[model samples]
Target chain A: MITITLFEMKKIIKSIFFFVMLAFLCVFLIGYYVFVHHQTVPVEKLIVETESMIHMQEQQIQELKRTINNSEDGGNSQLQLDLTVSEQLLSKNQILLKAYQEEDWQAVLQQEIESNEPEVERMKAGNEYYTSTFPTLFTLESRLEYNKWLLSHNITPVLPIDFYSWYTVYDLDFGDPIAEEYIKKQSEKYSSTGVYFLHHTLNLLFTIFGALIFLFLFGDILTKEGLGKNGPIHFLHTQPLSRLKIFIGKLLAVLFLSLFVIVFISGFCLLIGSLFDGFGYFYYPVLIYGEDFSFTFQKMSTVIFQSGVLFIFVLLFSYALLFLFSILTKRTLTAVGLTIVVLYIGIQWGKDTILSSFSPYIPFHYFSITDIVTNTFAASVKNFAFSMSTGCIVLSISTIALLFLSYFLFHLQNKLLH
Target chain B: MIIHIQNVKKRYKKEWVLKGINIKVEQPNIIALVGPNGSGKTTLLNCMTNLLSFHEGTVELVGKKHTDPSLFKEVSFLQDNRILYGNLTGYDHLKFICNVQHLSTARITDVAERVGMSSYLKKRVRNYSLGMKQHLLLAMAIINQPKLLLLDEPLNGLDPTSAITMRNILLELYNEGTTILLSSHNLDEIDRLTNTVYFMKDGAILKESLLDLNMRRYTVSVTDGKKAKKILEEKQIDFTSINENQISFDETTIDLQTFIDYMNQNDIQIYDIDKQKIGAERRYQELFEGAK
Candidate 1:
């Protein structure tokens, strides 16, 4: 039996159709990441130029203060003019603040042209000067300070000269405490670069495709026992083994293959991310504000283990569903299609009001409780114990329910003398 | 004894598929469960192996009751289509069956060889010709040297040569004390393979004919055509006519010399006398069609 299961696994791996789709998705993911990365470059440069302008304004302020001591109104008009120019620059670049944070730069550049602010034109005029001169003044070390000073002086520079109206008061400086927030947010930039969008779209497409493959391949996995060229019940029930063992063996085999596909997809995503986004882990958080917010291997392994337990429950439930449907229907497709439809409806119901109460009872709900697994509740009496106990209880009940349902269906199939 | 089924009744939707079937097959006997389509042959076979449930009945194979743990170990049911795994090759099917039967791993190769499928063992069962599929099934059935072999339509796709070879193999197995119960549409094949003939129709065994003529003792020697008539008249015996020189008797109890002496006493000159073995095909048709 074990050898048979291993052989089944090998067959799933050798499925050329599966590998072809995976390969296409892998390539598409990589290509999309590359495109997104390229788009991030221009935005990063714009941000860097804005930082340099703030520092330049600061140096000019210091020189003016020195001249003021020498003569009361010395270069004051010139200073005011420069201040006005800086204010104009800040207003011009205000759109970049919202764009940068939201990762919606394309929307801003596309939509900002109708604005009627003086700074939009000033920022447009200052674009070449800021781009060329800011580079000579600011180094890597002085860049942060320059951005801080300009932000304090209300100077925000929007990037890529676009024709958008700019009437609103532009507060370039996020705030004193917000500087840390901005830096933290800035490090994690969102880009709608062609590559990123392409990869995102491809991920959805491939995932849907992969799931469809699994649904079709395994949906009838058990029901095929009934619907093969031979009668399903005849072939399977005739074996010496009990129907329960056969069902379990087959269910485990499919789950094993599904897990393989899931891992394959995850690996493919990582490879794509590596090529395009400089290798960021999806589930693991990299350094954010010098703190490791990542759920590391040690932590993730627990999630994996818990997830494995949850998966067993799901597998059992899926088997039960298929088994019951198989018992009720003639063709394997009917069983499989009904299962997919039920799951779809179940998911939709869980999202809505009527069936949401039964969500805990739904096997699909337990599939993604990793969030619950990772969350460490506060030391309150109800929080920690409730979460932990509920998880374990629900897991136990779901497992038992699945097993019971499967056994009932097995008995039914056996009773069918046909 | 290999199998015993008593008063088994199975129904499919209001129709009784197997109506009170009672059969017992003891060792060293090849028994044919002859029946037509929808006749309870398969149902009874399944009941014996516990593949399907019967509402009322008792079935035992190798001393284990139906649904008993040991039932599967003792019986090998070769269904026409359901007996094989499609994805597996002929070799794989044999090996898997061997493993399931707890037979030696080498029995897979051995059985495949015996079935003359050694060359096609590696070919997938789905890709096999119908004849090849029959061979693979037979290989699996005999892989374990199972105490009781239950084959449903085992000869369905087999060619004449393969069928003869299979019959010979089965007889050899029977000689070694293996009990075989087979179902088939071919009455001729069944007649040759088994002594106990079960004629069935509409889910009931219509009649059973015991083939008692196992020896070659009944020889008809005709001296003169008139003398042959006199011997038949004097002895109160029945003989079937052939040509002018030969005649055959259906009974195996009569001696060849009795006919010769009876003819000689009648002053008839003896020439050539030959006895031919009776084929069971005619007897089988008589048993099935005559009763129906």
Candidate 2:
């Protein structure tokens, strides 16, 4: 079995398609870095711009105060309301600028929490506060309340300026407290290094491009042998080894190839990160979600390690599914097409539906390793919680089941070609 | 017994390709499976090697059932050219077989030389001609020196020289106590290689031995063809004339010695006598003539 597995691995390594796909992946990684750098405003530049806006608002507030003093019966009620809102906005901007200057996000969050609580209470007592006067401010107050919830749990806020940039510039929302905590932890750990950038970049890449890469890598593993002109399955089937062993050998070969490509791509990305930016510390914090939808912080190393293991499990499940389909269909294109269709549907429509209800149980739930590790799936989709250990166990069991079924069906089959 | 196939029946869809094939080989020797196209010759060989499923039979090699994983350790099936890996070199295939069979590297070299594939063993199979692929198949079959060798159309794409070489290699393997079950349409090669022939029709074994039929015929070329004809007529012997110089008669119908004596008594001079060997070709014709 080992010999056969080694031979199969050699075949995959020497194949031209494998190398071509790997090359394309590397190129895409580089292009993604370039696009991100072009789109994102540098932290220092954004801070400077925000300070200028704060200064201008302060001048307008002073001028309004002078006009009210000079007016006959003070300013009208509307002018008074505008003055109050502007003063509040100026204070919030001053806190953000101070946080940026000192690089102390926790202090800024504490001050903001202290400042917002009294206002929240005062607004809640006012009749027209939410419906007529300032509905959007109420929404902002709720987010502040969420930040207060994080602080009470001993978690620091990601700086408000960084949060604002992510929301406005990148159009990303950390609306969920759990998501906010994760972004905050990641932001602190990565600190604008290439590793930090790549860490975030890979999270997006895994969600979007993972299925396509898996399809290109393992789509035809079994069917190629059956459908080609040479029909090598005929030779393989006649060997003394059991069909189960043969299937396992091929499965291991696919895994070995996948790991090789992953490791190669990761190494290349790391090299580029080190040259362009610097490698981040291994002790950075990562936030995880529990089965009860509770959030917790874990070390970056542990999260990364768990993510890698879960990634392998997910890939095993996928390859096993493809292998079973390949044998059943006995045609490369049909098997590949079916696999792609199933994956696309699962990724697109599976969340927050009947499938998501079985979170940490169904293999489809574990397809996105990033979501599993970061607990995003649990937060976004109700009744679902992301657990790495559970995902790994579920995926492992399904992979084994799929492999057994594949072997059983393959052994009972007598014909190699149609 | 080296190979025992009992009550084997195979079907494709609703049609029976192998009705009930029962063959037992008590000795290690070359056995030919002769049949026309779609006569289930290939099917029988595949079933015996456990490459195809038989619905109602048991196939055993060296006293072990066909499903036994260890059976292939001592058995090798030489399939058609379609089974060879075209992207891999011929040596890669041979080495793979050797690895699975637990044979030494030296054995691969030896088999390559024996099958006359040493010159192009390093080339990929896609670059090979049909004849070269046939040679590689033969080499793979004998790499392990298996006790039972099953060959399906082993000589399909070989030239005359290569065919002769293949014949000699099979003979050598047989000499070394290997039992070979070969299926082929090349009757002359079959006739040259083995006397034990299994003629199949409609998915069943018809005759095990062609020599046992005892239907040999002889044609004689004589100087006095009219006198010989008159003598044959007087003796109530059946014979057919081949022009004015020759006459043909079944050896079984009239003894050769009696015909020669009658010719001598009637002053007839016999120039030459030839026996019309009823090999596989004639047996096939006689068996399938009515069915066709």
Candidate 3:
């Protein structure tokens, strides 16, 4: 089995297609970094710009108040309302800016929560001030509430709203709501400028072309031997190895190959990011959906570790599924096509279905493992209760089921041979 | 018994490609399977190697089931050239086989030299000609000196000299106690390699021995064909006239000496005599022609 796996690894690495796709991935990573840099605003620059905007808004509010007071028609009701909202927003921004300047995120979060509570209570009791502001206060109150929860749990409160405007801001036309939400949530959990860039870089890598790259790299793992008029599959079939061993050998080879590519590409991106920006704080906070479906922050290292585990499981499940398809179809393109189509339909459908009650049992729910690890899937999918432990179990079961079915199907593949 | 195939039945869709093929090889020798297209020669070989699933019965190699992985340690199937890996070097292929068979690297060099592929073994199989691929297939089949070797069209694309070399190698392996079951359309080469022939038609095996079918026709070109005909008629011998100057007769029916003596006595000068040997081709025609 080891020998077979070694041979398969050699074949994958020596394949011209693997190297070609790898080259394309490297070029894409560099291009993606450049594009991201162009799109996103630097955190320090954004803070300075926001301070200036706050000062301008304050002056405008004061000027509007004076003009409305001088008006003869009951001080122009709409202008008064605008001044009131602007003054409230200006006070909130000044407090946030002071907290940011002092780096006292806890104090900023406590103050925001304290300031929003009265409005939230008054809105619940039908107050005109909270009602007129409606959705804006509703969004602010939710952020403040979540931040207070983070602070109470001894977690640092990172304001997602502060950086939400810059997350994939220029790449908005991607039109994937889940990806957009993921980018927005990830951007909200800013630690340092460097970590912020790294976070988005990795997120873009996973959300955009990750699945397609996996398909290209591993789609043919099983079917390549059976391709063309003259195939080398017979040689492998005639060897002194069981069908299960052969399947496992190929699976391990693809897994290792994907790992190698992921590591190489990620390292390249990180190096490029560091050269241009810098490596951000290793202890940056990553906000994840907690057990109660509320937002909370975890250490970036822990989130990364969890993402890595989920990423591996996703690869295993996907490749094993593809392996099964390859055995059934004996065509690489067909297998790849079927896998991508099924996954696409599943993800699209899973988002709308009320499967949260049984989401842990549904294997497809775990396919988007990055979303699962980041708890973004919980937010999108109704009734979803995503936990890392449940996700691991679900993926493990699916992966094993896929592999066993693949072996069973592969054992009968001799029927297809002439 | 080196190989025991009993009542093996294989069906493709509604058609039975191999119906009740029961072949038992009790001794180590080269056995040739001859048939026309779609005659189940390849099917039977594939079944024996478990490359194709048979619907019924079983194939036992060296007293173990054919599907058993351990059976392959002593058994090797040299399939068509289409089975070789195109992207890999011939040496890579040989090395893989060698590693699977638990043979050392030295065995690869020895096999390469023996098969006359040492010069091109390092080249990728895609760049190789049909003949080179055949040589590699042969080398792979015999690299481990397997006890039971199944070859499907082992000489498919070989030149005359290469075919002769392959035939000699098979003969050498046969002498060394290797049991070889090879399928080929080259009757003459089969005739040289082995006398045991299994003629397949419509999924049935017709076992035959070339020694039993050793019939020949001797053609004699004479100066006086009329006189030779008269002499043959007087001796009550049967002969067919090729032309006015040449007469041919079955060697089994008439002795060469008796005809030569009679012609000499009749003062007929025999310019040339040729013996056309009856081989697998003739037997194949005799067996399958009626069915066709």
The candidates' DockQ values read: 0.32, 0.35, 0.41
> Could you give candidate 1's per-residue lDDT for residues A66-172 as a string of tens digits?
66557765656876677567666665555555566565644453434333233334544554222221121111112323223323333332223332111111122
**Per-model fnat list:** 0.34, 0.48, 0.60
Docking class of 1: acceptable
Which parts of model 2 are misplaced by more than 4 Å?
A39-44, A47-194, A227-230, A291-294, A344-360, A381-386, A415-418, B212-217, B221-272, B276-292
Better of 2 and 3 by DockQ: 3
Write one digit per residue (lDDT tens) for candidate 2, span A190-290: 23345555565556545525655776777777876763233677677667877677788888888888887767766776677667656654544455544
Better of 1 and 3 by TM-score: 3
Per-residue alpha-carbon lDDT of candidate 3 for residues B46-86, written as tens digits (9 for 90 to 100): 88887788999989997889889878888889987877767
TM-scores of all predicted structures: 0.67, 0.77, 0.76
Query: Model 1, residue B117: what's the lDDT?
Result: 91
In terms of docking quality, model 2 is acceptable
The alpha-carbon deviation from the true structure for residue A298 of candidate 1, after best TM-score superposition, in angstroms, is 9.9
Give TM-score values for chain A, per-prediction.
0.51, 0.72, 0.72
Return the TM-score for chain B, candidate 2: 0.81
Question: Ten residues in a row with the worst lDDT in model 1 chain B?
Answer: B208-217
Considering only N, C-alpha and C atoms within 3 Å, which residue pairs clash in candidate 3? A160-A188, A195-A280
